[model samples]
Target: MSTPPASAGTGIAASRWRHLPVGALETVRGNLEDALLAGLLALPVTFAAAVLGGLVGEELMEPSGPATTLDLTSRASLAAVAVLAVLGVLARGLVIALRGVLMARALAAAVRAGTPPTEVPAPLQWQHAHERSDRAYRRTAIILLVILGLCFGVVVPAAVQEPFLSGLAIIVAGAAVLGLIALGIPLTGTVLRRRQLALLGPVDGHWTQAHRIIAAGHVLTGDAVAAARAGRPERGHPGSAARRLGKVATAVVGVGATAAYLGFQVVAALAFPDRQRWAGGLPGERADLGPEAERMVDLAVTVCVVGGAVAILALVVGALAGLAERTQEQAALRRALVEGAAPPPYPVLQRYLRRRSAPLLRMVSALVGVMLVVGGTLVVLDGVVDAPSWGSFAGAGQGLREATGLGPGILGLALGVAALEVALASLLEARERRLRDAVVQRWPVRPAPGG
Candidate 1:
């Protein structure tokens, strides 16, 4: 081996990083701070929703019941709901923390294996794959947040005792707040990604050196590389219009189903015998109704069932399409890397790492599907079975119990799904980072520092 360079401090600097924690704590702290900021921004909207719910419940539903029963049921239901919410938050946090821990451990192992540290990007020199699917990811996230927020704002108030005008006002206000939040999410994510990439730094050398360095670092598992090798990347074709159209059908169906449901609600409200009656309503009980009212309710029940089914179907299909897209992207990246530089010939003994979060996406989808189905079933049963009024706290509690028992809490499922999507996005980001480092290392050309 050649003698070490003079100025020997460089050796010490490298050795220090060899034992470093690889910025795991920094990553978690940054993520938590971003999450806190997001929560703070959303706090006002959540508080407003809770206040409005309590006000409407006390004014209308409570007055219809014995005070003691109402108080007991309300408190019991709220407590149960709070407990479930806390559990869900804890579960999600645990998942994220565990993932970070594992990554840190792997990185530490890489350091111990003698992987050399790359030069970090100066603050102004940083560049990442923001131009890639990240833009689309952010946009889609924002759109989904806006759509769901509007739906909840409109639907929840209508479900309670809020007047039509009051519900409309809530929807407008919620949309405005969520719009700001939508913008914030992606910006925060971009900053975090940039910081992480800067810390990881760029590997620099020839293509062969790049490959060796990555292998030494263990940035990707062997199975991922092997799978990429076995799979053929999808190629664009002149006659692929039909396939492209098919891919988008899921989103279209989801949008259509949601629109149909909203339309049905509007039509039923307009056609009702007295619109004002809904403003102060009991869930299962109605005044002596004529045949027309009965028929309208039946029609609504039918629409809800069909619409919910379609929406769930759409989400399932969309999720599958997403997986396919990821697979294709991985194939393409793998092909590019292999063509540029060959990996080690010897087989690795490490167990294959399956994408754990992949199955979670399906689970969340199922939970959401079940929630929709249960809600539709309840409405249909109410229409056909002549049940007692469900507007009371006890009835509401019973409904909550049924819903929670059947599927995970709707809020929890939604949160889980969002987290999974974010995780998947991070995967794509990891791949991009590796590719960027490889390219820069091979070419020996760096982007000039700029803000």
Candidate 2:
């Protein structure tokens, strides 16, 4: 092993990174400062929304009786929710902006000193996505703050504890809805003030798009490599037409997967709480039926839930695999022609790994959805069904109990279906990879000098 570098040299190098201290305390402090900045950017927007909401609202401060319930669910409350939603969007953008400043500055420093720029995962670098840590913390914090304010302060004092759940749910749901809008506002904010980077692809980060990258690569390659894209036919070819078909097919699968999952849920909603009675009335009322009848009811619910889950998983996996293939194909083409790099190998494990991640995320979202459904079911049942608490039995060990109870068996089936989706996703991924590799192997990046 080599000897360690001297302490004096280490100190000299460390001087630069001292700005972003590599310690736990530093992280806490950074988050605090970042959160503060994010809050300031969001608070004004939220306060304005609150003001607007109050204007149209029936009464900002009032005790609710039976008669006032309809008025409480008034237009003003909706307006206030809208305002909080906008504030959440601003806060998310601010968090990203702060982090981007830190990252860009760090890169600029290294570049000035003749060093490599700081690099991170492409997903984190994605300008539009909201799932990244930098964005999530900011987003969740803003929503949490709004919920606390309205629920604890306004709603509770007014003797309407319902606002706590209603506000929290509203914020969560609003954040999800605004995610798409937040992405677009950064593009060209006229009414929306954009203090963040444009919500485009990674091409915006290093300053410029694909064509510029192409020009730079050709120059760097000494004119040896020419550019080609997934679409737009190459100078000479029948194969180009064929390639478009594959690209189009990949896109179609993505759309289809999204559609199938939606359709399945709509159909499942029709099945109801039990075959005997449709939901919407007194759902929780206990039936005077025998144990055998309950058992049958449980079995039916499990079947539908599991079966629907399977369909969702298959569609999701298939869709993602298709997307991954198209992305990799375009990237490979770029690198092969522009940078003169050989196409990378697409081992089965890689495809499997890529597909497995999606199922995991889907599992997380599904877990949350299931918890809400189960908990809410239990709550509603307390009022009507007169059965054992379903929400009490959840988690890994509780799985079998849930199946026995019939409430959880549906979830299990869903999970089983998800597994099938993973398998299908893997298969589709492998096929897509092969298609790209075949095309890459045949396509000549550089033609011999004079034909």
RMSD of each predicted structure:
14.4, 17.7
In model 1, state the lDDT of residue 29.
33
Q: Model 1: per-residue lDDT, tens digit, 1-451?
A: 1112212343323221011232334234323323323333233222222332332343324453344333333333333333333333333333333332333333534445566443322111111211222343354455556665666666765645677778668777766756654664555456544543442333222112433343334233445545544545434422234335446766676675675466446434634434455533423323465677656555554554455556556545665655554445445435544565333111211100112123233434345333333333333333423235434434344444343343334445545654554455345444444444443232222233221
Clash count in backbone of candidate 2 = 7
The segments of candidate 2 whose C-alpha lies over 4 angstroms from its true place after superposition are 1-98, 115-144, 147-150, 153-303, 319-451
Candidate 1, residue 306: the lDDT equals: 54
lDDT against the true structure, per candidate, is: 0.40, 0.36
Residue pairs whose backbone atoms clash in candidate 1: none
Candidate achieving the largest TM-score: 1
lDDT of 2 at 132: 31
Pick out the ten consecutive residues of candidate 2 with the lowest summed lDDT: 13-22
277 in model 2: Cα distance from truth in Å? 16
What's the residue-level lDDT of 400 in candidate 2? 33
Off by over 4 Å in 1: 1-22, 25-234, 237-247, 270-289, 341-436, 439-451
**Which lDDT tens digits does candidate 2 get at residues 409-443?**
54465346534544544444444433333332233
